[model samples]
Target chain A: MSSEGTQPLGRARPQETPAVAAPLLRRGMGNLATVAAHLVLMTWTVFVAFPFLWMVVTSFKTDQEIFFSPWRLPSALRWENFARAWTDASIGRYFLNSLIVVTGAMVLTLLCASMTAYALARFDFPGNRILYYCFLAGLMFPVFLALVPLFFVVRDLHLVGTFQGLIIVYTAYSLPFSIFFLHGFFRSLPGEVAEAAIVDGASPYRVFFDVMLPMAQPGLVAVGIFNFLGQWNQFILPLILMPNPDRYVLSQGLAFLAIQRGYESDWSALFAGLTITMLPTLIVYVFFQRRVQQGLTVGALKG
Target chain B: MHHHKYRLIIPFVLPSALIYGVFVLWPYAQALYFSLTRWRGFSRNRPFVGLDNFERMLDDRLFWNALEHNALMLVVLPSATVALSLLFSALIAQGGRGLRGAEIYRIVSFFPQVMSAVVIGVLWSFVFHPNIGVLNGFLRVIGLGSLQRTWLGDPQWVLWAIALVAVWSSVGFFMILFIAGMQSIPTDLYDAATVDGASRWRAFFGITLPLLRDHLQVAFVFMGLSALDLFALVQVMAENGGPSRAADVIARYMYDLAFNKSQFGYATAIGVVLLILSLVLSVLVVQLTQRERIEF
Candidate 1:
């Protein structure tokens, strides 16, 4: 190949021109490879999508059809399964409980993590590095290590089985990662902006809330999404803390449905219940795919 | 002015510190104290037993077994995930026009990351059922019927099955990390490599891997820590880590000791051991991945 003709294929620059050489024979092979790539990707996508599709299909099937022929598509849609799951399984009460706990946790996590990150980013104080490392150490501590003792602490405080108590625990658990991510974003901001505000005689609090917080909206949204998804799907903590059936979150309630076994393997209702629990996360993920991906990338790579 | 600065910092910092201290740090200290005593989770008073819990843990074969499984997972899952992610990122990064479709694949792969481990466990359980399961059905249709096995039911395969799911769920997150690292590398480096007549593989080893060291280290540490926190999957998939604790990991074993057996002191001992192991592993990883900062 001539130097000019081969440059695009050989070079790794962003401005390289697209290669458009070769006769019909080479072009046919290229087309075939492209087709094969798409075929492979589509097959794997179906594999990933199957379980979710199965759950949705079975949720609409009759109880009789659930066991004998789980593979078959439902002949008639059964919408009442959702209603029965909501009432009989007490999912409505669980939904409300989850909402309260998640909302409270989200607010607490945002306030504490944001303020701590801002302070850490802007100020040069004694024990600053040590404090930051302490937070990082928290990230490495396994959640199960805290479980045995947290039970006692919560019980002693008489917060057990209370929404506010669970919210407290959730907030504490989420703080480390939230502060870590937000601290990175805060560090990336121009130092001159805060310096300028300081020179204007603006108090640190005003500079933080009035100026910096708005600039960190993307970080806030990212951390908020993480906290929401995490708190919503939290199972073990709520399972241990909230023993009262009336206060079950969606995950704990769905798990209870599976464990009862009295339903004689009523896979339809079980699938319906799981689908209800999973829908909100799946919807949020589909809508904010870019942000979620960006968040995960930033959180992992930057740290 | 300095005192005022201290005042500003303390007010903002104290609430979080106090809550975290009382809730997390204090309880951990309490766990250490309780491990030396035999408290049945509730009593008016309990007596100190002094090293009895640690001794019991040393002799407990199941504890050793669980630790072994956790070590295996820590080695297998993160390394495989990082390797696969690096490969995928390289391919996508090189295939400029094809990157759009690759983005969609990345999104689908990441769907599993947001899912609860319980849900993934349940879904995979059905797929791996001994009979009428999709996996076996597909195998039979493809004339690989002899290779099909009961994935979760068998003791030998259960840990592998669980580990496979963990690795699959994690690859997307790490893939995104590798992509980000790739994006940050200046395009000029690759051009210089091409000009030097370096093959793609050579260029990757020389240019991409060294520059991506920081990102790889971070991913490894995070994934390693995550593998140590393996509770929900074992709880849902194997329901007490299988028929005879064959799929047991440290976290699940700790849960069983604390909740099911109600051996509070023994469970606290196990928790202490887990904490130490995680700390040591994280420190070693950080040390091994440490490098003199590249000025570039």
Candidate 2:
């Protein structure tokens, strides 16, 4: 929710009065428009949702049935396809590894981003503008630009092929956008609240934790969900950093199911693997859809 | 209070500053330094190659080709995607209220956003497969047989093919931003136009276009950066930017130089060039799109 008493809040909600007493010709035209809209929406929706639906359906069909009738729904639902995908492909282990990597990255990114955002927002220190611009520049710098040197840096620190290494890279990758989003939210907070707390003999730490942090909760949730989704679905960094089979995250592991040799092109198994991999992100999105959308739009438009 | 404020800023800022410095700032500085030296990665002694790497980059045909492809993408992908998304947003906006269909469209369009680029790349590869592929299959049924071509395998069409998929994947997300921007434009303007006997097209050009300028600029910047940094689809669709390096963006080029070729110094030079290009473009975009603050 936006801050209360900021503007005439009625602007947030569109009026919903139903139109009545339209002429017959106008009504007919309106009905035709509505039908056209639905037709267009449905056609595009099917196009968009087809791969996801196909992935689900293919995951259930037998391998023989996959190639024979790739488009047809399975005659019998085979839940065992998922079981095989989970066990034979070591997806379960990959899930845990991904969980570890995402969790570590999210925790560290949030902690650091929040502290950084709070400082930049609330304090008028020297070099504040310079510091803010530095973070903004990070947003524009493509991560690929850093890959060659980062590989050497990670190697020098002896962190390659480790969960810690992936976390560090992910955290560093995510910090710029995270800090950017949090900084906007913190800036929007009225300074009076923090000032009042400081005047009440509260230290900056106490004021940040006890006052500003609570106010910045929605922003934090937004940034956290964005980072979590990003880290969870990440393929590139894991592909390069975690070359060991044991260290593969879910995204890489699931992709391996589709690409690995010696395995028959089991469409069902690949679909099952993809479905399992996509579940966590889907759940997060469903729960915090609004915040995620807001975060994305704000991050883009504001930056 | 002032003294306490300085103390608070110190503790609050220190931790993040340290982490960011170590992981980001330091590594970036090192990347710049490495760009000037020929380090064989594992070798302890890195020869200071000076501008040799930069000079080589000037002559590297692949680098220029990749830059051309990136420029083409910057022109083609963002404009097409954003324009299409804006059109869709305007259509949906005009469809009036009680429209659950709009919600469905939003969800379906954004589904691709949730899927990883790798998965999308793999899935679309099958869709565009020449023989058993869906697109060709449809073309055959429609009697447009000659239009069927090997989308990814071809050197010429690979970039366009990949760009089409990228647009398809991203249009929904941008549409959402456009819709939000549309909503922010007060409906009274539309009402006023209607009362003045304005056509839908007239209202759109007069009211919608002007108000949506800020959102459009933002979408442009985001899509431009994303297009410039394209790698996942390039990696999956063509495996190595296809034959003759057709779909190679700067990111994939950087990856190949570092990981595939072990050309550390050359790769860093390429990376530095990309960084500079992105920075310059981003600044230009910001300057062009900067909106005067509106006091309501």
The lDDT for every candidate, in the order shown, is 0.75, 0.75
Q: Residue by residue across A1-303, what tens digits does model 2's lDDT show?
A: 122211222231222311211111132337766677678767777888876676677678887776566556789999988887788778788999999999999998998899888889867889998988887777766776677667777778898899999998899888888887788789999989888987898877888889988999988987887788788879878877888998899878766765672146655666677778778777877776656666665656655
Q: Clashing residue pairs in candidate 1, if any?
A: none
How many pairs of residues in model 1 come into backbone collision?
0
lDDT of residue A64 for candidate 1: 74
A40-68, model 1: which lDDT tens digit per residue?
55555565677777777878988777645
TM-score (chain B only), all candidates: 0.90, 0.89
Q: Estimate each model's TM-score.
A: 0.86, 0.88
Write down the lDDT that model 1 would get: 0.75
Q: Model 2: per-residue lDDT, tens digit, B1-296?
A: 67866776777677777666766777788888888998665666879989888998788898888889899999998889888888777656665563445766876787777677877887777677665356776687779988989988889788888998899899888877776666666656766776687777787777777776667767777888888877888887777778788888778888887887888888888888888887887777767656422311
Q: Cα deviation in Å at residue B138, candidate 1?
A: 3.8
